[model samples]
Target: MSMREKIKVAAARYPNQRSAIMPALLIAQKEHGYLPGPVLEEVADILGVERIWVYELATFYTLFHTEPVGLFHLQLCDNVSCMLCGSEDLLKHIEAALGIEKGETTADGLFTLSTVECLGACEMAPVMQVGDDYHGKLDAARVDVLLDSLRAIAPRAASVENTSSQQPGE
Candidate 1:
């Protein structure tokens, strides 16, 4: 079924079309991987709302990705608790393993690394999320195991080649 058709059905259950913006954005993201501008415009048109509304929602919420993301988006919480718990080290491990830095997507498009203010789990410091799963108490060993498992699931014969050795997102 088309995105519009799906969204139309979703909107029908809501009190009004506008109330379904969040769910519609999610639907669009599911279809497109990320909520690009054109997709947001289409969603707004379907909802009979202004394009700005869709754009605002997409950008405002961290959950709504506005650009292309890797197949696995690893969001590491870099807040005070997580940082104190060694999220920086965890970040380094992820960067070393994925060959990408925060705000960078792998050339293979297999992984994207990003930092979030909080994962809302202060107790689980140094937490990282891959897709919908939360990985807490991260260390070098665990990071390697996680990467290995992901690699085992979908082995990439070659790691993403870095175009420039310089820091990513420059």
Candidate 2:
């Protein structure tokens, strides 16, 4: 379905069109991979709302990416709980393994790494979020497994090249 049609369907469930901004943005992001100015304006135009409303939500939420991201977005938790539980070291391990610093995407465009305030799973401290799934209790080994799995399912073989075999916490 077209983005306009999808937005209409999502807006139908909400009493106010403004309420549908999130789902609308989600639809737009899925279609465009990122929310650029034109896409944001298109969403606002379709919803009959001001551009700011849509823009605000898009910028405020971490889930919504205003800029392009890789095929996989790795959001590691950096909150107190996670930090106390060794997130710092884990972040370094990921950087070394991927050979890309935080806030950067690998040259192959398969992975983008970021640090988030929290994943809201303190019980699973040292958590990492990939797409919609939350991976908790992370250590070097677990992260390696996750990265291997992601690369295995990557759209291209380029995703597997140039990655380090160095284990986390080694």
lDDT of 1 by residue, 1-170 (tens): 67889899999999877889999998888777788788999999999998887888899877889988877788999999999999998898889888887899889877889999888988888898888899998888988998778767654422322322223363
Clashing pairs in 2: none
In candidate 2, position 105 carries an lDDT of 99
Model 1 spans with C-alpha error above 4 angstroms: 155-170
lDDT of 2 by residue, 86-145 (tens): 999999999999999999999998999999987899999999999899999999999999
Most accurate candidate by lDDT: 2
Q: Count the backbone clashes (under 3 Å) in each candidate.
A: 0, 0
Instruction: Please report, as a residue range, the 10-residue window in candidate 1 with the lowest summed lDDT.
Output: 157-166
